[model samples]
Target: MKKFMNFGVLALLGMALTFGMTSCSDDDPDYSNVTPPTVELAKANISGMVTTIGGKPIAGAEVTAKLGSTTLSATTNADGEYTLEGLAENGTYTMTATASGKQSVTGSVTVNKGETAAWNTRLSNEATTVSVSQTEETSVEVVTETLENNEEARVTTVTVIPAAAVEEGEEIIVTPVYSTDYATTKAATTKDFMLMGINISCSNPNAVLKAPIKLTFDLTDDVIAQIKPMKEVNGSWVEAEVTEEGEKVVFTVDAFTTYSLFINATLNQNASTEAISFAQAEYDNLYGASEMSVGTATYTYKMGSEIGQHSNLLGAYLAEILAQQMAGSTVKTVNGSYEINVTLPIGTALTLSGKQAVETTSIAAGSTTVSGKSYGKVSVTANTYNRQHNGGTN
Candidate 1:
């Protein structure tokens, strides 16, 4: 038996949202003496249709919506439609669609007031389309160059480090089954609506082995500001340490599991922000200055403004640039372990070494918590558990 860590993407949207729209008339109202209304930021809903190049709905396609900095993702239903919540109704947004064998498509949409927008997108399998094949050559040397940002006094870099390949005659199998069942039990509502997950799988199963994969990133000053390296689990980012050799960030695994990158960022601001924890909604409210919003974070005036969540995001996987890195990902095998090295932002480097594993009964059925250790939220489906295997046989 062997122990191998799994890597995967978990697009989560636990927060529910509701929005509505009202059309204004051409008539103008006199407000020379009327006081302006206050603004309260709130979450909005975004949804759309997805189809194949042949006009067929694309079920299970990965769909992600990004506004300014924050991003949310979900899978399409049987109707080839997806709905992403926990988004602020304060700005314009873009959505990306990805499927197993189709060319991915990206489009923009808007969410206003309490009103959600409807967008339609299509994926193609045409010759011009690029397939996201998991297996690509992984051996190449790397060199890097840096770029600078004047506003933030920061520098960006694009590094090209190629990982070694597996020895000849090794069987290659790639499975997408990856998970770790860790959930929040303290509160269902505050169950941490932030983060994404990825399941790592390979040709060998249930064995004590390591899967090595690398990411090639075009680092920018803004991206490095909010970067975190870890696996999201039970309301936590399980840190996995990576070394920065030149332009690459490297990781080594020894068991089946899910992985993530947690980015903590703020929304784009128009006016200078106050110490106040709210966004400045740029329009007028349905009511005068005295009108207050309840059970909602949004004021009618806050529609179409600058705003975002006040927490770290578990959402890098939804970005096209992130996916592009994997397109060039490579891995090599030695004995029973895989070697993976990638060029990406080192954000806040982390590690899983010396961390204690939870010894529990069966995994808590679904996304639920037990005692202080949550399970089922992050899961790995593998042939062998690392605790039982001895890191593959000689």
Candidate 2:
């Protein structure tokens, strides 16, 4: 008898996906204005067989694939097959294959340059009981029920979520300007600026089954401006304004990095929620930053059409570094604002480092709670080859 295990969406898996980026130095200057290598193309092939506890192929089962950094979908065919094409790089790829009830799976794959690889998966029996569990910046574990015949065909799946989710809110980008000469006079804003539509992923398969997620902001930018500052000019306090002349300023914001989705997993006969929670917490504390900063955010900024294309979040950080690298640069301070962005060396990495905590094992065993922390160092590196060719050399 073939045992059956139905792990819900495999969101809490702690898999490491490394992005190999080469950094450039100003000393090794090219000066040519070269265009950095943008995502030229991207593609995906999703093929999977749908089966029941009774061992029969179910036609027309839905299987969708998400391309690098985007939430768009490419679904499977009537023959239980699917594929996503037109991806650019031959880097690490994250995929989620799903069909109703049959445990959904999310995993990472390496797609070689111009290569059309095959992604074949098998769907298991539908889940009997809906349950949920979570681990902070670590990993999420989910187990499924055994086959009716008492065979052990259980599946425990884990997926890595961004560390930011566990901490507070989705990651935000802020821009502040500084004077080329006087770096101490912090710049000021007259109005409250808004950078909206920030989206975060829930890496816990069980999270979706539990409750909707919420992230609050609490970030400070010692380099740029977070909250604008003002002083009493003529007996009345008013916001300071930035004239054509530059002023030094710092900025920052904090928010939830997870989504409104929930996860629900059950404790099947073969699997324990305790084991899963522990594994996830450890993983988050170890590599959550790397996966999000390097894996998800970097990938999105480099490829996606949303915020990545408009705001040079990475580019802005690079610009700050560039300012820092110049001779005789200094930082400015604001009176009322807490967070700010300071000028830093161009092409220098903005290390994003932090940590997360494990929620509770009790939640997995029928309780209604999930928790954890998300921490790490998020640094941005400039494209060396592109800078050499484009930054004036060309």
Candidate 3:
């Protein structure tokens, strides 16, 4: 009987131990004291309206915003309104708006976290009204009037459109688009010249004329002497024959695209002749009969055997002129780049090898190559003197 009592006592001890273990197992870990990981939420948005300079709503305009590799796009509604959502907050986006029969516009906007940023784009289009009749030729004037910084000026461009250029009774509109963005426009031309005219485009896309259209610009004699009429062909500016008649400049265009007056000058004013010769020598040595690699394409720049070949010397002279023009500006090397301090108009940009510098407080800085030569740094600032007009009516 004493041995059976001891076995019962041992069984009771085992039951108590098992119960203690069961109670411990039932309790969960204290995860309440641990912190949770953070998750970022996209709460920023960009919304805007795309309209013409006259405040006309542009329907079917494609609006795109780019931030790094992320691109968000939207189409404008009938009201010309568009919105891009779920963008990262506090990020700046480069915005572009493009529509048929309109000049594409580009700008930038910064959106804050949990907020919608408003960015409006005003596209430029044909400003002149035309009524095509059964006439041999029609003449229309495109006028650009500007009142900037309390200063007012007017530019009037006259184009003699031949009847063969457009269909009879088909309305034609021509608009002279004025841009102070010299840096951007300068890239289209191989010449180193200051833009001092307007870019004129017709309402008709890719309109080629059976007969040459007469274009005229009114300007001071001094200005006309320094300017040349250029027409954009195949995305490059080629000099068109220009003549000074009284206080006006005249040129003929067989095709209507972007036409402008470029201020032509030699870069080495003191050594113009010698500079031309040296540049021609360099061109012959570097590019003549040899393939020059640009990006991924190789091009052979053929030159005539003449001493003053137009194409060969043209590129060199223009490059020298541009270099001389910027020589007076302040230059500094920053982070192994050339930084040039130049003052331009408010809307203008400083372009180096097709790369534009970002503007801040009227100052823009960038680094790029110029004519196969790399610069450590370069910059441009807004010219406080707003009266120095490069091109356009105002």
lDDT, candidate 1, residue 59? 90
Q: List per-prediction Cα lDDT, in the order shown.
A: 0.34, 0.27, 0.47
Better of 2 and 3 by lDDT: 3
Q: How many residue pairs clash in each candidate?
A: 50, 101, 14
Residue 386, model 2: lDDT of 30
Cα lDDT tens digits, model 1, 72-126, are 8999877676667656545778878889876576667666543344445555442
Of candidate 2, the 10-residue stretch with the lowest lDDT total is 299-308
| Candidate number with greatest lDDT | 3
By lDDT, rank the candidates, best first: 3, 1, 2
- Model 2 TM-score, 2 decimals: 0.23
- Model 2 segments beyond 4 Å from truth? 1-68, 130-394
**Candidate 2 residue-wise lDDT, 290-369, digit = tens:** 22222211111010000011122322222222221121111111011001122222232222211211111111212322
Q: If scored against the real structure, what TM-score would every candidate get?
A: 0.27, 0.23, 0.42
**Candidate 3: where is the Cα deviation over 4 Å?**
1-85, 88-94, 97-122, 145-151, 163-171, 180-207, 225-228, 263-394
Residues 1-394, candidate 3, lDDT per residue (tens digit)? 9999999999999999999999887894432222211112225667666765434567999999998998999998886767676676468889999998777877787775533455665566635666655557789876643212111124467887776566554555565654423224453443335333445455566554556667888766544555567766676666777777798888776565666766533222121110001111111111123222211111111110001111222332233223223211112121111222233322222222212121111110111112311111111111111122132110
Which residue ranges in model 1 land beyond 4 Å of their true spot?
Answer: 1-48, 51-198, 210-218, 232-236, 266-394
**What's the lDDT for residue 350 in model 2?**
23
